[model samples]
Target: MQFDKPATTNPIDQLKVVGKPIHRLDGELKTTGRAMYAYEWHDKDVSYVYGYPIGAAIAKGKVKSIDASAAKKAPGVLTVVTTLDVGDLKKGKFNTAKLFGGSEIQHYHQAVAVVVAKTFEQARSAAALIKVDYEEQPGIFDLQAAMASAEKPDDSQEPDTAVGDFEAAFEAAPVTLSETYSTPDQSHSMMEPNASIAAWDGDALTVWTSSQMIDWWRTDLATTLGIDKEKIHLMSPFIGGGFGGKLFLRSDAVLAAFAAKAVGRPVKVALPRPFIANNTTHRPATIQRIRIGAERDGKITAIAHESWSGDLPGGGPETAVNQTRLLYAGANRMTAMRLATLDLPEGNAMRAPGEAPGLMALEIAIDEMAVKVGMDPIQFRIVNDTQVDPEKPERPFSHRDLIGCLERGSKAFGWDRRGAPGTRREGQWLVGMGVGAALRNNLVMPSGARVKLDKEGVVTVETDMTDIGTGSYTIIAQTAAEMLGVGIDKVAVQLGDSRFPVSAGSGGQFGANSATSGVYAACVKLREAVACKLGFDSEDVVFENGQVRSGNRSVPLAQAAADEGLVGEDTIKWGDLTKTHQQSTFGAHFVEVGVDVSTGETRIRRMLAVCAAGRILNPITARSQVIGAMTMGAGGALSEELAIDTRRGFFVNHDLAGYEVPVHADIPHQEVIFMDETDPMSSPMKAKGIGELGLCGVSAAIANAIYNATGIRVRHYPITLDKLIGELPDVA
Candidate 1:
């Protein structure tokens, strides 16, 4: 079913299930510990061997020699597969660094070998026996230091945007503000480590792994192994968390597959916590410069955003300037990205990739500009809001409610109560309030699914869509239930299997709408099939109460599938609607914070996010996504940083003890409100993604709140006490 045109009135329009606040359908399985994650999968038929990976000691060097004789003689050691034995393996398409680097190590802690044993403990213990002698070489590990000789990245998704004359307008403006902001490297630090179980029978390989994109991993795994794509089966039934960390195939799955094949037994591998930071992908640090020229009336006349980031060779820039090209109506605007070569763990997508760090700078710049002009920050944003894309005025937004969000959020947050900085003091606390506009593009992707109706009138939807704790299972089931005119309890959802129909695979904030639209397309085909089986006109058949009715005649849906289960498969093909119209989501984030007058410790008092992202499929899960992302954004603003030791070319803080994220105590009351709205062009479900939307401008809000409280502005991220302590007022 092609979604070439805007969605019309459909069964989902009934609003009986799709838009309701439904609890996660997989909640029970997850809470009861019945759901099996990759490392936990147990098969009675296959004797499981364990593989512990050994990482490179040197960041960049040639391996002089590897003494693995001690490991081979270790107790229960089945086999030890090293890069020397594997030779030159094909690199996966999505991988930037070689997974099993040996001769010349690309990065620190890159997996060089795997020791397989009868038990995990034995494999880990024997892995310590292997000794690798290396010749160390200097490598670039810092983004700012490498930017001097930076080159344009080869695989950048979006180059840059420019309009009119940004330099001239900025120079002519009487009121101007220019500032630089920095965001540090961040680890996904998902609860579950990268793990996989691989078993090969003859030429066929089956892997149960923890990944976001199952088919992408399958094809990449096959490519890495030099095997037939059709011969591999990948399954990821449940995931603890991804946040873009599991978007591609990791070393664990590939290493386990090869080790299992070598040992002639099924093997499971899980990367140890220490290796996770330096071995896998991370969100690259960025240094961004934002210049804004505004009139005395607080209208933005010129805006320019330039960002510098570092990644491995052949890797892409973070594209941190994307939202700046469209978020506001600046007559002269420009945005550019410069990429530097760094050997730090291959930088890649993490949550709201481009806009996350981008907005951290841009939004704070807006706040500073507003203060410079002696205007309200919200008013400044409203004065510059663009109904059409600022880069392409010919393209109008499908839906934009940023003004409404700010107005509503301001009222709810009591924005009028905010006073002058350092004026409102309670004991040793300086209290202030700040707000930022949230913006993220609404992307659409073609997705496919298969829906089956059994003889018992039960509906089952099959797609490779992953839940990833985003409630994909619950929302997909709700979509099918709404279409079939049945309760959600009657709908079963099957996901994360490559054998199932391909889906959008849960990335870029397009998964929810695209995957559910795929299910909607399949359900449309099923409705037609049911109509044909009941000898009724396909266009006029109505499905209700587990029965299909046409005119005065009705038949049980189960009767149509009495002999065999009915199947319907289709793909939701997109048209040029997205190109014709600038589709995007908008929101407002308000934060109230208290800064310690003496120590400069900032703590959030209250927070609120008002979103206008098409439709809300499940408010419960949508709110959860928003609050969770808000918490992550708080960490990104105040604490999270993957500190790199440039001399050693490795993340110094490799474990959770050093890499801090927000605990419950770090975050305060968070409220989320979704505007009552929907966009027909978004999808049949009329929904856009909220998972990443919640993260968009939250850091900026916190930073603005800090400025509001202290009258001191810090451009660098993780606004630590050290950065603020020196500039703070002297308290006697």
Candidate 2:
């Protein structure tokens, strides 16, 4: 079913199920511990072995030799699979570095070999016995050091955009502000580590893994193994958390497959927490420069954003300037991203990816410009809100409510209570409020699904869409139920199996709307098929209460499919609508922060986000995504940093203890409000993604709040107390 046209009054518009705050369908299984994760999948019928991966000690080097004799003699050791045995295996398309690096180590902690044993403890203890000799070589470990000689990366994902003459306009403008900001690399720090259970049935291999994209992983695993794609089956029904870390095929899956093949038995592998940082991907560190020229009346005349980030060779830039090209009204606007080569772990998508860090820098620059002009920050943003894309005035927004979000959020957050920097003091704590406009473009992708109606009046939706704690299973069921006019309990959702219809697996905040729309399309077809079987006109048939009604005739839906289950499969192919309209989600983040006068410790008092992201599929899950992103943004603003060890060429703070995220105590009262709205150009669901929208600009709001409380502006990220302590007012 092609979604080439705008959605009309479909059955989903009834809002009987889709818009409700339905509890997660998988909640019971998850809470009861009945859900099976990758590492826990055990087949008692078949003797299962365990694989423990050994990582490289050196960052970049050539393998002198690997001695596995000691490991072979270790207790219960089955077999050792090394890169030498694999012999230059084909790298997966999604992987930036070779999973099993041997002669040329890409980065520190890169998996070099896997030890298989009868038990996990035996395999782990034996893996320590294997030794490797490496010759360390000089590698570029620092982004600043590498930026000097940086070359354009071959895999630049997003191109540059320019409009009018930014430099000239900025120079001519009387009120202008220019600043540079830096954000360090960040880890996903999800609960479940990258884990996989691989079992071989003759020539076919079945892998149960924790992944965000099942079909992509299956295809990539087959490509990397040089095996037939049809021979590999991947399943990932439950995931603890992803945050974009599980978007690709990790080493655990590949290593488990190899170990299972070597030992001729089922094998499971889980990467230790230490391997997560350097072994997998992370959000790359970025150095961004934002320049804004505004009039005395708070109108933005010129805007320019340039960002530099480093990744391994043949990797892509962070595209940190993406939102800057379209967020505001600037006659002369320019945005560019440059990439440098660094011998660090591969940098890829994490949570909001581009906008999360991009807005951290851009929005704070807006705040600084507002301060320079002696204007209210919220008023400054509202004055510059663009209905059309600033870079392309010909393209107008499909739906934009940024002004509404700001206005509503301001009232809810008590914006008038905010005072000048250092003016509001409560004993030893200086309190101030800050607000930032949140913007993230609504991205659409072609998604497919298969809906089956059984004789038992049960509707089953099959799609490879993954949940990843985003409540995908529940929302998808709701979409199907609403479309078929059936109770939510009657709909069963099957997901995260490569054999299912390929869907837009969860990433980039596009998964929720696109995947659910695909299910809606399929359910529509199923309703038609059932109506046709009952000799009813498909166009005029009404599917309600498990019954199909057409004209004067009515029949139970089960009766139409009594002979055989009715199946409908279709893909929701997008049209040029997205190209014609600038589809974006808008929100406002308001934060109240208190800074300790003596120690300079900043703590959040309250945070509120008002979002206008089209029709929400499930308010409960949408709020979950927003709050989760808010928590993550708080961490990004105050704590989360992947401390790089330049000398060692790896992240020094690999474990959670060293790298801090927001805990319950760190995140104060957070409130999220979703405006009642819909966009016909978005999809049949009239829904846009809110997953990443909540994260964009949140860090900047925190940064601005810190500045408001202390009268000192810090450009660097993680906004450490050390940066504020020196500039703070002298303690009495």
Candidate 3:
């Protein structure tokens, strides 16, 4: 099924099950601890060993030598495999740094060896026995020092774009504001660390891993291992969380597979908590400069955004200027990104990626510009709203309700009651409210699925789409149920198995719409097969209440199936619809904060997000994603930062205890409101992704709220108390 144009009335439009707030079917298994993770998978026929990885101590240079004799003779140690032993291994296409073999120490904590043993303790103990010497080399660790040498990233997804003469427009504008903002390197901090369990039978290998994109990992693993893709099978039915950390193949799976092949048994590997930050990908730190010029009447005339971040040689820029190019209407607009070579960990996607950090700076700049022009921030945004892309006016949005989101969110947040900064006092606390616009691109990918219809009128959907704790299983079941006209309980969902059809694989907020649309396509084929089996016209047949009906004739849906269940398979291929339409999700985030006058500490009083994404599939799960993202955004504004070890070139605070995320006590009330909307251009489900949309601009709302409460503008992220203390009035 090619979704080339806008969809008409489809089975999903019936809304019998797709839009309902249904409980997650895997809720019980997860809460009860019955769902097995990668390292916990048990197979009675196989004997499992433990593998502990040894990472490079230095950030850059070559390995001089490794003395592994002590580790080979250690008790319970099976074998030790080093990068030198494995020789050169090909890097995956999506990877900027090598995972395992032939490591020249591209970054800190690059795995150089793995020790396999009978137990985890033995493997760890054996790993400690192996010693290596490295020839250290000076590497660039500071973004500021390398900024002069930074060049425009040639491999960037979207290169620099310019519309009109931004310089002239900005110089001529009466009202203008210019500011610089900084965002620090941040970790995913997902509950489950990178883990994998690999087993081999004959020449074929199977790996159970904690991964977000199963097929991507499968393809990359084969490439990295130099083996046939058909010889490998990957599965990850459940994941604690990814946040984009587990989106690609990491060292844990590769080392585990290598150890399993060497030991002639299954091997499990899990990265210790401390290694997660430096060993895997992180959200890169960014330095952004934003200049906005507007009319005295609050219409934006010119906007320019430039951002620079450091990464490995082959890595791309952070793309912190993306939202600036499309978020508002401006005739003279420009956006550019540069990348510097740094010896830190590889930078990759996290949550909303570009938009998340981009908005942290862009939205705050918008708020500051609003104050300069003497206009309400909400009104300023509304006045500059554009239905078409600012850079490409010919490509209009499928549907945009940013104004609706802002107006609705402002009313609910009591924006009219907001007072001057540092004027609103509630006893010892200073109160204020702030708003920021949310924007994330709507992405669609080719996805496929297989559906089976049983003789007992049951439906089962199989796809490689992963849950990543985002409710993929529940939503897919809902889609199959809606299409087959069966109760959601009667539909079974099997996911994350390589044997199943390939799906969008859960990243960049495209999983829900793309994966469910794949199931919808499979169900369409099944409906046709059922109509033919029942001797009825496929176009006019109706599937309802587990019955197939055509005109006055009706029959049980199960009667159309043979003794064996009927299977249907199809892929949802996208054409030029996305190119023809500028598809994006929009929302507004509102935050009210209270600042302790004496301590300069900021606390969130309440939070609300108004979303105008296409039809929401499951409100319950979608709300969970929003509130969770809001909490993460709060952390980015108040606490989260990956401190750099300038001397050693690594993350200083690499563990969870040193890094601070919002706990339950730190978060107050949070409310999510989704506008009633549907976009035929999105898919047959008429739904766009809400996961990353919930996180897009939330951090800026907090920053804006803090500024409103204290009258202090903080350009740096994680607005610590020190940044506010000097500006606050003396307190008793």
How much lDDT does candidate 2 score?
0.90
What is the per-residue lDDT of model 1 for residues 1-732, given as tens digits with 9 covering 90 to 100? 777778889899998898999999999999999999999999778689999999998788778778899999999999999887787788888998888733778888888899999999999999999998888888888788887887755544666678999999999988999888899999999999999999989999999999898888988888889999999999998999999989988999989998999999999999998877888999999999999998899888999999999988888888789999989888999988889988788899999999999999899999998889998899989888889989889999888989999999999999999987667778888887888788888987788999999998999999999988999999999999988888888899999999999899988898899999999999999998888888999988888878888999988888998768899899998888888788899999999999998899999999999999998999999999999999999999999999888888999999999999999999999999999999988888888989898999999999999888888788899999998888777530
Q: Candidate 2's residue-wise lDDT over 58-166, tens digit each? A: 8888778899999999999999998778877788888888887347888888888999999899999999999998889988989887777765545446557778999
By summed lDDT, the worst window of 10 consecutive residues in model 1 runs over 152-161
Please give the range of 10 consecutive residues that has the lowest summed lDDT in model 2. Answer: 150-159
- Candidate 3 clashes between residue pairs 3 or more apart in a chain or in different chains: none
The per-model lDDT (C-alpha) reads 0.90, 0.90, 0.92
Per residue, candidate 3 scores C-alpha lDDT tens digits across 413-484 of 889999887778898898889898999999988899999998989899999999998999999999999898
Best by lDDT: 3
**Local error of candidate 3 at residue 227 (angstroms):** 0.6
TM-score of each candidate structure, all chains considered together: 0.98, 0.99, 0.99
Model 1 pairs in collision:
none
- Show model 2 residue runs off by greater than 4 Å: 153-156
Query: When superposed on Cα atoms, how far off is each prediction in RMSD?
Result: 1.2, 1.2, 1.1
